[model samples]
Target: MTQISAGERDRADTLASRRDKFILPDGVIYLDGNSLGPVSHTAISRINHAVTHEWAAGLVRSWNSAGWMDLPITLGNRLAPLIGAPADTVIVTDTLTILIAKLLANALALRPDRHVIVTDSDNFHSDFYIADGVAAATRRDITVRRTTRAALAEALDDDVAVVLLTHVDYRTGELLDMADMSALVHAHGALMIWDLAHSTGAVPLHVHEHGADFAAGCGYKYLNGGPGAPAFAYVAPQWLDSLTNFLPGWLGHARPFDFEPTFEKAPGIRALVTSSPSVVGLSALAGALDVFEGISLDVLRRKSLALTDFFITEVEERLPGVFELVTPREHHRRASQVSWRHDEAYGIVQALIARGVIGDFRAPNIARFGFTPLYLSFRDVDVAVSHLVEVMHHREYDDPAFRQKNPVT
Candidate 1:
């Protein structure tokens, strides 16, 4: 790996101009966008307006006047293009966990005869947990089976009802082939569910185009909504009239205000709404998404690849054999982030953060750095790697303070 010309690359980056839209902290090279995207100026403005004007003045009237009641679908439509999904198929609703539960259950409902759900060991923990929980809830002898990505095809069988896989490996930043996987699952006659938590805004996706039966992802990562930002779920329009909403709320009722004794499903994307939309969070997310309105995923992907490639190059040159590069080197098989494996990855992450380079540590031994093309510049990547070089070379992380574990980490 060899470093690219940072000065030249930054001048040529088309997305570099968009960095002004975000309100990143001064003096911090935020490489943790894969975990939690920082707030943008538009997001802040939207949040302020929602707090001061919408909620404070309109009160309950905001549901109708401010379009709060429709945010779940509206925001969903806003995010659809990022994933190459059709407008009516996506809905920003609930947390990723809740959405995962709903999506997996919905797929299971469509395959009652199948007794097994297939997922890889590398899938997000929440996804596996939800799959296991849904299997347990079935009470009809259903089981959740886990395996490696390489064996996903072998894991699938006539008994497999649904297959859930993360588009990007959360810890290793490995990108999976959505089209290939979806086709394989379909060949086996099982519905495919994609957990897009790590790839939603970080990579170019064709969720609906790739024939994914269902999908879910977070809003706080590369999408840049604030912490605790709402998550989204996607249901193929083909199942609009048939998919079951396991956690139905009044909003999902066909005639929400009808208040009928029996539950009636709403039409289209509204069918996925489980409860009232988070007005403030949606407001923030809508504002945050403003920066992405006219952006091209192709352009974004190119910038991401360059940044990661450069970072990996600089690391290999400066740090030598200090850490093992765990993220895939193949551009087609990598996400917008990079990770290195080290025994003291946690301490290394802490040391970098103390120096104002904010990356994150995944469990076990992974130090992760996310590169967001929308706001991150080549200079940012260069500076972050420079700090990492210093931290490792100086043995600054040898201090006991850097080794202490936080509850969150």
Candidate 2:
């Protein structure tokens, strides 16, 4: 059913030569990098060394000798460049939920006189939930405003203490104008906190350049830091001097080991820490980041746009009536993914996976493909399109098993 030619196949085959760097399953077309990136060769080797040699052999000594104690800060410094943040502004720490709580709680502390915490309607659910909890904990009134950019711009008033938003929309892959939004928040005497879960690695970020007061993102998504990987939080350098964390555990204390009776928080980013770093996970993530050693995010962004655009074009031309594109077509307004809306989206996703094209399905009607340029190739994209065409034309997604809802989806 696919009209792809042998020349195109050969070109994709050549492009796949670099795929050896990833530990992907044979015959699988992994289009879920935006969810969880496949492990890299370097990550495996480094994790193995850390588990067998560094931790197993060195034990407690590894904290000081193997530099385990500083992995969070070190990894933060490494990730700073990728996210356009400066050193000491970012700290690799707990899950995104915790990080968001810390950032919001700290931001609220900065503006006790102001009562409102404004956020978009489409923010990731966890962010909204965390903000709700922070409001309850602080006994402060929270106002969530669901509005478009123009709406938000108009709604920005002096009463808003902090403006929260995700840089990229999870479902639609829509990118928000962080710089403009942050400027508007500051102009209204409010701080801005961003959720970067979908933006950090999918595209280039400039927190400092955008004048963001605080930000947080998941480690397992675009960062390719693996499942349950430690997330990161960024506090602007200027706020670092006054930022106060409510979750001040012993690990965050300035003299944690001094057997102090009271909690005296560590200075700067260290104050955000509430627990010891996850050593094994941090080690793996640290190793995985090395893959981007010579890679520029600009190049990554270019390739990402190309891959998503190619997918969109191929889908539109090859299966026009069968699939409906949900992601924005405009390049500047989109992220690194292309999503399609179909009544049988889940079933079609199952069929594609059965045939070895592995994308993901969102709720209701969205089938999502995350095109990670570091491991994806043009040929793989072609092959995926070929499989998709077959599944669509043959009506293979009509299978009952494909329709059954799974717990994970």
Candidate 3:
């Protein structure tokens, strides 16, 4: 609980020299990358080229000549290493909700006799909502178990057809043991569909190595594909021929361009796709991923841990009793963010943003701060803590006018 010195902070800032790749605003310490990442310079340029050259000039030919059509699977291949999935097993496509529904239906098709879709009650709202739809559509029961890892293990019974869970808790940044949970699910004869929204870029993952049957995640959050970026899905290659596509649109047909009369599933990752790729967004994502071409997740994890640990310690030293930590203290059980429970979380978040230290607010009283190793520095974390201390001690967060609700928190 000690404040790091300005000299030490300066050294940390120097270490963040590589952050020049991002187009961050001056004097702003962005700590909401967990929700939507800041646009990178490379992403911007890539989008520009796609817009001007690929779309405007090339037009329809771009789909083949410019390789616009191959982006979904191509980008998926690029993303494979990040998620620890084999090549041709992942595909950049529709939103996580849509992908979840498709994968859930596909899994249900495989187990016609099973009626229960097991998931954690604390899983992200979208996942729960989709599970509800699956129940209604198939006349199957959805069993939501709101419990800890230990309890979850007990909940995975033979009746469970699929075990759905988020790799990291969106609210508290709590991480789950994928390997352990997969083993438990397999023992119960259930398939696992992991929501990698908070795990993909924040931590190292090995879906195939851990035997994950299915997975989905957002592109905008950690992949930095801008708002409404195309999400990706991972289906084990073993299910390539057997798994059915609930939304077997022309894009997923064996010969999409052929415009066949019957719905024939395409082979490999192509079969998982549902529609035309988002060229602009995918272009941006492809360029954004280039920033990590040779980067090691080990180095990224080390920096992430240092940043979160530094913020927590400095906050405790400067603003004790003002807020209570909601995120886990154990490094292994944590993600890339830190959260604190406070009565005036919304107002505090607004005040922090006004001061140019832009974090975010979650529901019910949680102030969240995300630290992206690519753009955030130790100095930024130090400055953010200083601003936080000022807001609390100077009563700057007591404003009644700044408490208006925002749609995109």
RMSD of each: 1.1, 2.3, 1.8
**Strongest candidate by lDDT:** 1
Q: What digit string (tens of lDDT, one per residue) describes model 1 on residues 54-88?
A: 99999989889989988988899999999888988
Instruction: Return the top candidate by TM-score.
Output: 1
Local distance difference test values of all predictions, in order: 0.90, 0.85, 0.85
Clashes in model 1: which pairs? none
Ranking by TM-score: 1, 3, 2
**Candidate 1 segments whose C-alpha is farther than 4 A from its true place:** 1-4
What TM-score goes with each of the models?
Answer: 0.98, 0.95, 0.96
Q: What is the C-alpha local distance difference test score of candidate 1?
A: 0.90
- Kindly list the per-residue Cα lDDT of model 2 for residues 59-129, writing each as its tens digit: 99898899887787889999999889999888999999999998988888899888888888877788888
Q: For model 3, what is the error of residue 284's alpha carbon versus the real structure, in angstroms, after optimal superposition?
A: 1.1
Cα lDDT for residue 240, candidate 1:
80
